[model samples]
Target: MDEVEVVVAHSQRATLRVGEVFLKVDVDPAHADVEVRAMAMVPVPTPAVLWCEPPVLAIAAVPGTALGVLGAPSPASPAAWAAAGAAIRRLHDAPLPPWPGRKLDDVAEELDRECAWLLANDVLPAEVVRRNREIAEAVLRPWTPAFIHGDLQITHVFVDDEDRVTGIIDWSEAAPGDAMFDLAILTLGHEEHLDDLLVGYGDADRDVIRAWWSLRSLTASHWLIEHGFDPDEPGCEFDVLRARMPDS
Candidate 1:
């Protein structure tokens, strides 16, 4: 018998791997339904759903390893990054998902709350939080929505040895949102590959994408720490936030 391995364990969710099968345990039962439905709708490659039992969904793991991880150099070739970009393009070009994405007002309110928390908790210097928060505002405005993989982080994408995309996983957050948001999330903490990814994804609002880098780092750092992941690594989320400051 293959030993079960913990893929990820957080308060809201956990994933366990047993050989070729991955079991996703979500706190919210509705998320499982959305993930099952969204995976069916996406044109790109995704893990095959084997079965679902309320809070737990079992899926066949995809063939390839992750394209990369946040805060680490990607072993994947530039071509792999380009392939990921192309995959994202395919997703955004597809028809909108049945559900709507987050409202701008809600996002702004959350940002304000997170910023206050950061300062009050001394997680980051007040000036650092303030400057990045200002930069983040650029992407907090209205925009035409597209089919976005709401949590399109690099770790969620997988690729073969030849730099070909094999599949994408973690679909619970999939929804309609800003196209750039997906691109920004994919390239977060890995800006060096932006040029490669953009080659396949095509031109975009560079400023907005950069702004989201700041926004993503600012909003996600606290939660990551709470979940037992360090955001203060040399090239991780905290570094990303400080990168946006004027004198960095």
Candidate 2:
């Protein structure tokens, strides 16, 4: 029997790796449904769906290693980052997902709610949170939707030794939404590589990308903390929020 290694365990879901198979067990069957369908629709390389039984979805492991880890310098080459950008462009150009993602108004409302929670709990300095909220306003406007990987973190993208993107994982949040949201999430903590990623992605609104940095960091901190992860790591979520301060 293969050893079942726990990849992540949280209230909403848990992921386990048993040899070359990754099993994702989600509390929401809808999430599993979305992931399975999104993987099929995406033109880029993705893990093969082996099977799905209710809460558990089994997928073949992707080849190569992740492009980078959150809050850490990416060891991947510039070519790899460009490849990731090109892959994202392909996804965005694909047909819209069957379902829609959060509306801009909904995102703004959630940001407001989360910001209030952050302030009430003192998770972040009030001024820091406030300033970022102001900056985040830039992303609240209507966007021509695209197929977006709602959680396009650096760790989600896998690259080959030759600096080519082999696959991208975690499609639960995949839906039709702002393309810049994916771009912003991919470059979250690794702002220095924005230019390289943009070279392949082509034109993008830099301001909106920056806004998403703040919006994502603000909304994700509480969830991360609840899920047994620290958002305050030097270059992690909280730091991403702090980095937006005018004089940080």
> Alpha-carbon error at 87 in model 1, in Å?
0.8
User: Per-residue lDDT of 139-202 in model 2, one digit per residue for the tens?
Assistant: 9898998999888989999999998888999999999999999999999999999999988889
| lDDT tens readout by residue for model 1, 120-226 | 99999999999999999999889998888889988999999888899999999988899988888988989999999998888789999999998889899889988
The ten-residue window of minimal lDDT in model 2 covers: 100-109
TM-score of each: 0.98, 0.98
User: How many steric overlaps does candidate 1 have?
Assistant: 0
Whole-model alpha-carbon lDDT for candidate 2:
0.93
Candidate whose lDDT is highest: 2
Clashing pairs for model 2 are none
Listed per model in order, the count of residue pairs whose N, CA or C atoms clash below 3 Å is 0, 0
Candidate 1 off by > 4 Å: none
True lDDT of residue 157, candidate 2: 97
lDDT of each: 0.91, 0.93
